[model samples]
Every structure is written in structure tokens, then in C-alpha cells.
Target chain A: MANIKGAVVVNKERCKGCDLCVAACPCQVLALQPTEVNDKGYHYAFMQNPDACIGCASCGLVCPDGCITVYKVKL
Target chain B: MDINEIIKPENMVYTKPRLMNDNPMHYCPGCSHGVVHKLIAEVIDEMGIEEETIGIAPVGCAVFAYNYLDIDWIEAAHGRAPAIASAVKRLNPKKMVFTYQGDGDLAAIGTAETIHACNRGENIAIIFINNGIYGMTGGQMAPTTLEGMKTSTCPYGRNVALNGYPLRIAELVERVDGTCYVTRQSVHTPASIRKAKKAIRLAFENAMAGKGTSLVEIVSTCNSGWKMSPVKANKWMEENMFAKYPMGDLKNV
Candidate 1:
């Protein structure tokens, strides 16, 4: 596999904190903020290990909210 | 390249589907409808058929599908989406027409319409969302609900003697001669999402090719109605729903 890193931009306002994306991530890079809640009073997903992300976008594809955007950089 | 530099549009790897607007979906958290909607938008966008596509919205939670997807839509009465789609397809045979319906809308109410549309070989597609219970109606036991599944109406759990068996609509439609494709899929996981998208793409292509009816059954989860967290709901569906209604293609031609 090519050496690549990934990042995600989550739209907090739309996120329902379903944790589907968090579970779908192969690298376990995402998790719902335990204390913080969005305007909708839902805990949104955020990258816990951004560097571990592979840019595979498994989280984005599995996201029900369509709020997560993925970016990749080749090493 | 650094992460910041790669964050530019040119370096973007994946984003939301173009057809899916920024308007927030009304579905509950972890609802399968959003994922399925995104898949449909991606399929239509990828196929470049947005202009020549018409969707029929059902009288269920997905009745607002027209608002979500920027496309021509016809609001059909309860259990009449297939009938509406049939007419739309016949009139504009070149356009891709499909229906978005839930278990209550398709299996319970629209059963005859769905059956006849498939049996007649209408050049249309049906996206059936079977979550077992009537989500919009407050967790009532639907025709597709498991025998022992509990719902608002069935507080004591579904009794086979009191209620009929869970309807296997996909398999039932598979037996119809007119149906060209029939598949049962779920979108809880990334891999399954991809497969479901592929199945939908094939179904859309089938409709475009005038191949006969293509029914894509999405065995979904109603987290709110099921009174479980999204994660637990998915797990419950995988364990319980999958047992009653297994995944994979029932018929593909």
C-alpha cells in the first residue's frame, strides 16, 4: 500500500453522534466527544487519532449523516 | 505534501454526493435512510442521469425524498409508489424511475401494487426499506416484523398466531417472472455500503435498460422506534433481522 495520511472534516451541526463512522473506521481514528455536544445536543464524531487515518474513507462511506469529508496526502 | 496543503479541493479524496444538498436529513441518528439516499444520489450523479430521472416518494418517512434529492418527483399515496412509478416509466420510457418505500408502505400497504408492477415487468426500480417495524408510525409491528419482535402495538412481542410471518418481499418478488433483479442489502458497515451502492447502481442500470423490475431491499434499522442506541440497533438488526431476512442477491439477471 502507498504511504498516505488522511484527515476528516465533520459538520458538527448535522452530526447526530450515531457512532457509525466511528465504528466503521479501520484505524479507530474517530470517536464521539464524551462531554461536548453540538447545537442539536448530540455528541458529534471527531478524529481521535488523525495521524492514524489512512484516507480509506470507510467512515465517510458508512456515515449516515453525510457530514464527514475526507482528505488525503501522499507521503 | 502536508495535511493542510492536501486539504485543498484538488487533494480531496472523498466528499458528499453532489446531488445530496446541504439540507439536513430528517431521519434519526444512524437511520439507514440517509446512507441509502446518499448512495442513490451518488449512483445518479455518477451515471449522469440526474436530468432524466424521476423518483416516486411514498407515504412513509421517506415521503420527503423529493426534498432531499434534487430531482423530479411524484408524491404517491400510501402503498401506491410502484403504480405511480409504472405510469411514469411507461410515459417516459427513457427516464429512470424508482420508488422509495418503507416496510409499512411497501410490504404491508403497497403489497399488491408492488407485486403487480414487478409481475408486469415495468421498467422501473423499487428501493424497499424494510426495518421490520413502522418507524414513522411509532414502532408498530409491520408485515415484515419478526415473529417475536416487539413494537409499540405489539408490546408483548409479535406472536405468529396473532400476526403472520415476516414477509420476505425480495424473495417473493424474485419469483415473479418480470423482475430482472432482486437483492437484500444493509448499509451499516462500509463494505456493505459499497455493495448496496453497487446493487443500486445495477438496479438503476437495469431500469434504464428496460430490463424489467429491479427491487433493491435494504434491511434497515429503526433506532428511535426500536428504542435502542444507533450502535445497538445495528447490532440487533445484524443478529435478529439478518436471521429472518438474510442478505445477498435473491435473483439477478
Candidate 2:
């Protein structure tokens, strides 16, 4: 089976929830959630699909806050 | 820490540096300057030039760029970012230098400084934020204000017979021989934001690599000055400003 493991990680405290990263991700793996607040009192977004991540790194490239990380798992 | 396992849409960790701190920016809510600021910070972070960089803030809405960008900064006297950047770089040739300016500051009163800096080919990065109106000074008519565009100074839509057409600063600067890289991008949406960041990073990288003066003109929105919502402001820029200042690389020498 064609498969990749691992997931994307985000630093909650630094995320501004701007959604720029969400918009840049091609796999629709990032989303700005209304749930959770960072230290700065801003509602930080959470990643939804870690396994679906292709590790293209576009999220990291476009995130204004540098709060996103994508990793590929070797099974 | 499964770092990757804990990954969800909201918890993704980005590799770009968050140079912009938590300080509240002085720009109005709907101002395009905020977007431009974010774009610049993102670019600086991606280029890894934040630590050894000095940025000059102009006298318009972009004057407070220092507050948003976490880097060594110097405030210029209204539209003189190029001049200040020129001096700062000349004094410390090893450091990367940049200037953030607006239409009112760059194309209007500071025209001479901008032209000469580019003409002299000072090795500096210039982030030109063009929103067309004099945002800080109560939405006054600026040199780049579009024809038939109403501003405080031109209450009844700019008249070409009176104010002439909008000044295309990017085109004018591209004609100068000293300017090695010049590109105009917009920051109205995510896709455009990506493009803007690429352009800005390239400008910074070019200067850091000892290239000649590099300029990135960002077509931004001035919601407060334009008397429109942030979303509408983006729309207005797409409809009006884009026609006046089409996005693309003007000169990449």
C-alpha cells in the first residue's frame, strides 16, 4: 500500500489563527479552530489531519507565525 | 512528544520564524498595512535575516513597522526610508538593510530620495506599501491616488484635469539603471500573500547577497482611509488598485 505516517504539529502559543497556513496547505490539513487560546489570548488553530499530511512544507512556508510543522513517518 | 502525532489542523508547527511579536500594531483594523507587515515579517523570517538586519520606517501608516517587525529599526522622516536605509547600510556595510514605506511617503514628498537611492544602486531592500490614499493624514489625496478616486483632499473623486492620473512609482523606479530587482505584488488574499512573501524575501536576499537596490511594491488596502470594511477594501484594491498597478515583476536586473 502506498502509505506515509506521522502528522503535522503546531505551536499553540505562537499561532495567531490568521488562517494563512490553512489556506496555503494543499491537502487541507490545517484549519483555524474556535476552540483553544494561546498565551497571547488569541484562539490558536489546531491541525485536523496529521496522517493525511504529505509533508509538502507549504504550511511552514506560508505561516506568518511559524507555528506549523509537518513530518513524514517511515513505517 | 509525538510532536507529529499531536498534530492537528490547529497544532501544526511552522518552520518560519515568528519575528512579529505580540505587540498590538498601530494600524487600523481594516488597514492593508497590517497584512503587508505580516508578509514582510514572514519574508524576513524565511530569509533568516532578522538578526542582522536594520529596517527604516517611513512617515505614513507604515511608520510603525518597527512595532510589528522584530528587528533593529530606525524611523525616517516621512518617505525617507530609502535615504535612511542608504545611510545605515553605508555605515554598516555588513548588515542587511531595508526600508518600509507607503505611497504618500514614497511617491509624494519623498520622491527624490526614493529615486536617488534606487538610481545610486544602494544595496538595500525597499518594501513599498502602496494603498493610494494618505491613510494617516485623514485620507488625503496622495500622488498615487487614482483618478476619480475621492479622498479628503479630493472630496469629489480625483479629477485628472486637476490632479492628473495616479503616479506609477514602480514603473518610474524600474527605469533607473541602479535598481537591480523590482517587483510589484499584492496582499489581498492568501495566494497573493504567498507571492508577496516570495517577492519580499527575494528582495531581502538580493540585498544581503550584495545585489543592488531591490524594491517590492505591495498593492495594499487602506480600509479606514478608503471608508470600507477590510474585506471590501481587498475587493476595492482588486478592482481599482490592480488596474492602476498591475502585479508582476517590473524589473529584475
Best by TM-score: 1
User: Which stretches of candidate 2 lie above 4 Å from their native place?
Assistant: A1-75, B1-17
Q: Pick the candidate with the highest lDDT.
A: 1
Candidate 1 C-alpha lDDT tens digits along B1-253: 4557667887687888989988888899999999999999999999999999999999988988888888889999999999999999999999999999999999998999999999999999999999998998788999998988889999999998889788999989999999999999998888899999999999999999999999999999999999998889999999999988999999998
Off by over 4 Å in 1: none
For candidate 2 chain B, the 10 contiguous residues with the lowest summed lDDT are: B8-17
> Considering only N, C-alpha and C atoms within 3 Å, which residue pairs clash in candidate 1?
none
| lDDT of each residue in B1-253, candidate 2, tens digit only | 3554545554443444478767655666445566566677767776677788898888877777778778999998977789889998999998999988888899999999999999999999988888899998899999999999989989999999988889998899899999999999987665777788788888988888878999999888787788886556777788988988999998986
* Candidate 2 DockQ vs. native: 0.22
- In DockQ terms, which candidate is top? 1
Q: Rate residue B140 of model 2 by lDDT.
A: 95
Model 2 per-residue lDDT at B10: 48
